[model samples]
Target chain A: MRSVILSITAVLLALLIGAGILLLSGASPIAAYSALVHGAFGDAQAWQRTLEKSTPLVFSGLAVAFAFKAGLFNIGAQGQLLLGAIIAAAVGFGVEGLPAVVHAPLALLAGAAAGAVFAAIAGALKVYTGAHEVITTIMLNYIAINLTDYLANGPWKDTSPGNIVARTPRILDTAALPTWGPVPSGFVLSIVLAAIIYWLLWKTTFGFEIRTVGQNRHAARYAGIRVARTVILTMLISGLFAGLGGAVETQGVVGRYQPGFNVGLGFEGITIALLAKTHPFGVIPAALLVGAMKAGSSQMQFVADVPKEIIDVIQALILFFIAADFLLRRLLRLKAEAGEERLVLSTGWGSGE
Target chain B: MNPWRTLWHYNRGKVLAAAALVVFVVWAYTRDPQIVEAVLASSLRLSIPLILGALCGLIGERSGVINIGIEGQMLLAAFVAFLVNVYTGNLLLATLSGMLVGAVLGFFLAFMSVTLRIDQIIGGTVINMLAFGLTGYFYQVGLVTKGKFAPIPIPGLADIPILGAMFFRNPPLTYLTLLLIFVVQFWLFYTPWGLRTRAVGEHPRAADTVGIDVYKMRYLNVTLAGSLAGLAGAYLTLEAVGSFERAMTNGQGFVALAVMIFGRWNPILAWGAALLFGFATALQTQLQFMNAAQIPASLLWLKQIPHQFIGMLPYLLTIIVLAGVGGRTRPPAAVGQPYVKE
Candidate 1:
């Protein structure tokens, strides 16, 4: 509970500093914040957009959070998400004559599968070749971007009259995810899925294997867990969550996978995951907060005369505070737990070879 | 001989990777000779960022600190260089400015990761996030404007041969990169400073006992590496496109990491590995011509094939080579550990 208060205060402190910066920039902090609040919860329309935007953020956050649980930081969620969106789009457009329920699930499943495969490449390489997931994922990200770009530019291009944007055509209407009045149904799905992920991570046998592998591979191995398999599966599951986010973005919000539109969603997931301390359940509120900030940023900019970049600055500060943890440790006067080292990278990032 | 036995006896990863490469080469060759040349040309050009980026990683990681902020540093350097070069018609100034910016970033990272005992991965990730958003916003807003860096024509090198024209005729940064590779190679192997750096990387405790300040050494190496990465970013705008764009580097930083792995973390090996990447990029371009008649127009997936597989090539090859060679090729004893003084 103290930790929660601390986090909220940290976020508020950042907002105040940001508002001070706005004043220095000749903007009214009060006006900016009011506008931000109004814009985010301004009306049904504003709420819809915010929720629409957050639908993907929730899953991406979950993706990063899940990977963090296994002690593997997945910096490639962006690339994996792209793979998911593109492959899902491919399946959506290519497959013919399937019923609505089957078609929607199939496309969604395909996207998740693609993300898993893409993630598995990094995992498999890590297990087989000792390649770091961070590095491999980064490389794969470039490939994913270009591969998707080429596909959008070439065969999958919307070829509709006067459309110059590099993107795929909208999927069959039946394939799109449903929405509830002002709130996107994807947001609800994301909530449900988050619960499932939390259960899978904390309660299941597989979850135990993952946490064990993350904490200490040699010990996990001694305990008869297939360390390599766990590592790969953890990444796969993490990636599937990320891929679902991409699919949601495509079918629910944008109706097409535009390149720059999904730009920072995955990286933002990193920030969200960190702020949540990589808790699967913690990601929901974290996502909503971030989603609101992102959704309300332009409003903050317009009415408050504050630069939208201030939000990013605040986000960066939050990440710095969390990652450095000097402030948190000082404020709480929390004693270091002897065994809590298992929560982070315990055994030096190695094969223990 | 049973294929499975032979495959299993050795590293199946390498065997599979090698087999894939052979298949690709054969497919490339059977298509068209002219296409091959075009692909070669394309690959070489595309490899510019990767080769230089990998060199940055080699220098940083070789010193025992894992610098994941290479991408961020590169982005910052590229943006700053592009802006400065455009404002002033001086290429040298832009390059120097880029190195300076990179060095500052590197110093800060080293201070945090090395001196303060912060987790290197967290430190690197923060740098990446901060750099990405900072640079991206700067570009979006008019804080940094893009422009051209001076292109120089090499005196005799440009006239020497066909290869010289493509390699030497345009930007001075290219030659500087090539020369720096050798400079780095010589420095790593023959110089006393190089030996100490290697020692720190391999066994920092031993080096510390031998009178080297491990923290100081890492700080210097990381700072130098930041500048190198900055230069690579600068090259993207100044040397190649003559402008800076958002995320201009794409993922060359990762490609560099792969190259570092493939190069066995040796400077010379890094250089050779970089050229291999460059060559692979060039080969893909050449294949475009080959597929002109054979592959259907819409099925032009062949053209984008390299896009999907190119970055992986270095990594996949790294896996193959390392698997075949085994982890006999080791990183510094304390590559990722943050040093804290008691």
Candidate 2:
């Protein structure tokens, strides 16, 4: 309940600040926000776009949230997502003549596997070499971006006649994820995955072990847990989630892997995870909220002449309030919850007491 | 403990240099030797921004603050510097304003990391996000046009051989970066203030017990480091490219963090690491310009190497160095922890 309240307060504060900025910029805050709402939910098509946008965000949010359970910050979700996306696109287009049932799942699984392997590199580095995951993941992201761009532009360029853009050929119809009415099948799968992740984190023994390690690594070690194994496994699972996101984006929306088409989707996951307070179940609504913001931004720009970049500002402000939550706590006059576990993300430099 | 033995113990550099020289001689036999000079000059230009950025991390980490927002700070400063230059046309004012903006952001970082006691990484991420949004929005309004600094050659010095062309014939900020590396190294190791900063980062509790104002030291170091990062940002627009683009700092700020780790948090070592990274980066364009087809016809496979792979070299090398060498280097003992007086 406290988490819910805190989340609501942070969202409200962000909106208020955003409104103030809108007013300062000579736009009617109310009209702009109304246009944003209408753009996201005013019609069936709008709802479809919003849901479509939210699908990958949900997956990436779950990725970050799951890693937080094992005291890992998987900033490499972007890279992992990219790898998954390209692999999925490759499998989607390269192999031909398979039934939809077989081909789609195959592509998705290949993407997920690629992501898991990519993330496991960071996990292995952390355990064996003590290289910080944050730095390693960040480095991996740059490499991933360049790798995908190269493949698209060079060897993997669409070989179709008259094609000039750097992208893969379209996936076969059988490999595409189908939508049910206004709701995308990908969005439904995301929700189901969120439920499964919630159960895995809260109900399963493995989940308990991950949480234990996150709370206190020394204590978890004293309790005889294989701390290293848990950390690596957590990262693998996290990468799986992000990879699934990329795969879904390919199979469901994009239908082909293209540079710049999926630029900020993975980063949006960070904002969603933080807003959800890293709860697996909370990711669904958090991702939806952000998706709506993204979906509506263009319409807002078209209707009100407000720059679409305003969404970025709003997201940043929301993150600021969430990270610096003492201000929120003070504003709400909320007492500190007893026995609350403070965030413990990484062990700095050399190992010592 | 003998000096000669100690020098030999660090023989990795000697071996690597000799191997590189052999490769260079072989390559020069097939192509122009001047390509090597161009490579060195480009590496120096690339290393300036990176070295200054690493110094920012060096000071902040030395004072127990893990600043992951160097990228964001640089972005904001670049925008501000370009905006100031566009309006006033005064290069000095624009550069100073850029550093000032960086210092102000540093103050906020100190407030969040030190006073608010937020997780240092989270705080830094916030700064990055904020900078991204703020700069992207304002960059449009600033309406900056072409404003690059012309290269100023030092009289007589610029007339020398390869060394002069690489070092002396450059913009003022590039020279400042070269000097800053030494100045930062001297201040970090030789000065009393530097000792106190290091002490606080290593063990703030002990530092507090010794009557050091741990908070003050952290705040000062982080804020001052922001100015250095800001200077690096100013260099991006004023010295390097002479214009601003959204997210123009790119991942150089994060690469700077890796450089800091590669150098084991020492300014001099960090400068060396920055140059190595700079060399890797410069190699990318040079390889493209001096097309791989130029390689002896027998080495046909080299021609197949794609430009994208070449671009990936610096980032990939960063990961290798971090996993291999950086893992052994210890950061300041109390880094990423907020100090609390008991």
Candidate 3:
């Protein structure tokens, strides 16, 4: 209940800050916000766009949140997502004559596997060499960017005449994710995955080991929990979630793997996970809220002459308020609860031991 | 200890750097004699911002605060510096204003990490997102700088064949960065303030017990470090590129973090690491140029490799270096932990 209050308060404060920024920039806050709302929820198309945006966020959010359960910061979700996306595009286009069920699942699994392998590189580095994931994942993100760009432009380039852009061929229709009336099937799959993740984290024994390692590594080690294996497994699963998100984007929305199309989608997962307070199920509403903001940003720009980047600023402010909740607690005069488990993501650099 | 072993232990980084330089010089001589000078000069120019950013990171980390927001600091600083140059047309004022902005950001980070006790990583992420958004939101088309700082070659020193072109003949900021590197190295190792700062980072409780103010040291170190990052930003706009683009700092700020780790948080060694990365970047650029230009028959093999793969050299090298040496290099103890007075 307290968390719910905190989340709501943080959102309100962030929106207020966004309004102040808008006013400072010589725009009417009311007009801009109303336009944003109308664009996001004003009609069926807007709602569909919001759902599409939210689907990726759900996968990425679960990715980061799952890794958090094992005290890992999987900052390489961006890279893993890229790998997943490109591989999925390859499988989608390269494979032919299969039934829709077999082809679609095959492409998705291939993408997921690519992401899992990429994330495991960082995980293995952390477990074996004490190299921090924060730094390694960041480097991997840049490498992935360059690698994906190479594949799209060089080997996977669409050879059809009049196509000059860096992108792969469009996936076969059989590989496409279907949509219901006003709803993307990808969105439904995301919600189902979130529920499954919730169960995995709370109900499974491996999940117990992950949480135990997260809380106290030494204690978990003493309890014979195989801390190193757990850490690697957590990262693998985390990458799988991000990879699945990318696959869905390619198969459902983009229909082809294009350079620059997936930019910031993986990074936005960081914002969503934090706003949800790393809760698997809570990711749904958080993703929806952010998805709505993204969906309406262009409309806000047209209606109010405000830059769409304002949404990013507001999102950052929301994260700041949530991460530093004491500011909100002080403003609201909320009492501190005893024995609260503070969210400390990783034990600094070089604490792999 | 044996004298030779002791010398190797004390100057391992320098020895390795010297060895690498010998190999590079030999390789360049075999490829094209004139290419050596151009690549060396380009490498030094490329390394200026990276060196400054790494120093900024090392200082904050040495004082117990992990600053992952250096990229944001440099990006915002670059944007502000570019704007100041456009409006004021005073290069000095623009550069100083950039540093001032960086210091203010540093203070904000300290407040979040020290006073509020937020997760340091999350605080850094907030800074990054906020900077990206603010810069992108306000950025407009058609804004131009009046002028940029011209290279001021040092007398006699600039006359030297390769060394002069690499170091002496440079812009004002380049000279300043070179001087700052040694200044920082001396200060970090020799000064009383340095000892106190190190104490706070290693063991804040022990530091508090010994009359050192852990929180104050952190605030001071982190805020000062912000100016270094700011200088890096200013260098990007005023020294390297004459114009500002949205997100111009790119990933150099993060690369600076890698340099810091590869150097084990030492200012002097970090400079060497920065130069290595700079060389990688220069080589990549040179290869791309060569590919675009009419290449000699001897260099036909270089054209076979894609430009994107060449571009990946620095980032890939960073990962390899970290995986190889990251475990061996120890960070300051008590880092990323919020201290509370009992």
Cα deviation of B47 in candidate 2 (Å)? 0.7
Summarize candidate 3's per-residue lDDT along A238-315 as a digit string, tens digits: 999999999999999999999888887788888888888889988899999999999999999999899999998999
Is candidate 1 or 3 superior in DockQ?
3
lDDT by residue for model 2 (A224-300), tens: 99988998899999999899899999999999999988877777888899898898888999999999998888899
- Better structure of 1 and 3 per TM-score: 3
**Residues B202-256 of candidate 2: C-alpha lDDT, one tens digit per residue:** 9999989999999999999899999989998999999888888889997888888
Tens-place lDDT digits, model 1, residues A93-143:
778898878988888899888888888888887787666677667666766
Candidate lDDT scores, in order, read 0.74, 0.85, 0.88
Q: For every candidate, what share of the true interface contacts is present?
A: 0.21, 0.59, 0.69
DockQ of each: 0.23, 0.60, 0.71
Better candidate number, 1 or 2, judged by lDDT: 2
Docking class of 1: acceptable
Clashes of each: 9, 0, 0
Candidate 1 whole-model C-alpha lDDT, 0 to 1? 0.74
- Distance from true location, Cα of B72 in model 2, Å: 0.8
lDDT (Cα, tens digit) per residue for candidate 1, span B1-342: 432353355445544665686577557556654454345445556666766777777777767788777888888898888878777857789888988888888897887777666667777777777677666545544444344544577778765434444566555677788788789877877788988988887778888888999888999988988888888888887777777777777667766766676666765556655666776656554455554666668756767664545545554554454442444345667787775555
**Model 1, residue A77: what's the lDDT?**
92
